[model samples]
Target: MIAYDNDNIAKVEQAYMLKTECLFKLKKKEEATKNNLLLAKYYLDFAEGIFQNDIQGALRCVNYYQKGIKLYRDNGEPQKAEIAHKRLVEIQKEIPQIMVPFSIELDIKGVVDNIKINMEGLTFEEGLIRLTQMFVFEKQEDIKNRVIGEFKDHPLAHMFGKRCT
Candidate 1:
């Protein structure tokens, strides 16, 4: 049971987490559960503080929000858990899109938009990657190298097992 004060969010979070763990070990189930809830909310506050400075922190927020929701539910606070659960879903929805550069996203979308085949068994990413592969492999070596060079510093191609290099 650490009281939140002017201390930085991280310190407050650590204190609550340690207290929650200590309480559980002392056979203080009720106190542990309450502190667990506090620690969960602190996770949210910490993540939101990061998010305010950088929207890219949504990736980090996903983990914190998921932990918060679980802690809330396990502590008999399902109503509180639901709020965090919705935020988790929204963060998950935004993750795949957030890291991709605008130009790269447009390139992939251009391929996806003009596709002639039915990508019935594929995710949108799988289908786009298939097209990128076909386009890359069909080129003469010089052109192939040049096109891949464009994405050399970008991660989406490499992340999907297609090395742009």
Candidate 2:
């Protein structure tokens, strides 16, 4: 058995401060997407610490996560935004389900093989046709050109570039 500390408030504050310091250091790094993801996680952790005592504090933390999602999506980083959104969904489960004013509706299906889209609620038949036309039967040079022009420096870009060359 372990002893419990009565100074829980102090401990939470200390942890929050340490995370804030780490976030400040991360802001200076070049990985903007990674930095935002870490920032959201830290904020969520801090919010979880105070949720029982402070509803406002918990909501503030969720707001910070939403900002991270926006930043990621705006920077052409839908994968990172999806990550933040998933975290937000998990956190939201602890609170009431009332929809927030700034909620975003992302139709992403999966991240494997370059972020498969959900096809905007299309039926199975339509989706199959769209997939076949877009992926299965698309010409090689067209796919290569689109990937190279849009996904420069991406792993997919490098892989396709090698084949193109």
Candidate 3:
């Protein structure tokens, strides 16, 4: 029992140091500032998880880590969030990606509201389709070009413009 307690204490201390180091590195990666903060928070959370019974300390750690995450997000470092979020998704299978619909009202009414397409674990292709469907009605040539470029061999590309002739 003593050994187990010692192990937990060691892990918590190591995690705390790693979190501090990550925060220090964050000052250097200004562009990836958000990502660094996320990494730090993850380490902090891991440390807190090791000391779950210490209710007050755990709560304090949670608040501090949450604040770090919030600061990064509020500062518009989505790429940083994306990195952490991807890891979260791998671990828990329920991370939400920002899939801005191309046409929210139309697609919501036509497809989402009526059909029960279970795209829970859909691949990138299917996800792209869902994202594209939202903007299908909009007549934005640039968006169309981008979509076509993204899915060059996609069957729908031909419908948008001239075939590769």
Best by TM-score: 1
For all candidates in order, the CA lDDT equals 0.72, 0.57, 0.50
TM-score of each: 0.53, 0.31, 0.24
Ranking by lDDT: 1, 2, 3
What's the ranking of the predictions by TM-score, best on top?
Answer: 1, 2, 3
lDDT of 2: 0.57
In the range 83-111, model 2's lDDT, one tens digit per residue, is 77897887778655432323335544343
Better of 1 and 2 by lDDT: 1
lDDT string, candidate 1, 1-165, tens digits: 256552465677678878878898999999999888887888877666655334467767777788788889989999999988887777677676666443232236555555655466788899888777666454498777866886786745555443221
Q: Write one digit per residue (lDDT tens) for candidate 3, span 55-87.
A: 454444445445444554765765655565554
Per-candidate Cα RMSD to the true structure, in Å, reads 12.1, 19.4, 19.1
Candidate 3 weakest ten by summed lDDT: 95-104
For candidate 2, report its TM-score.
0.31
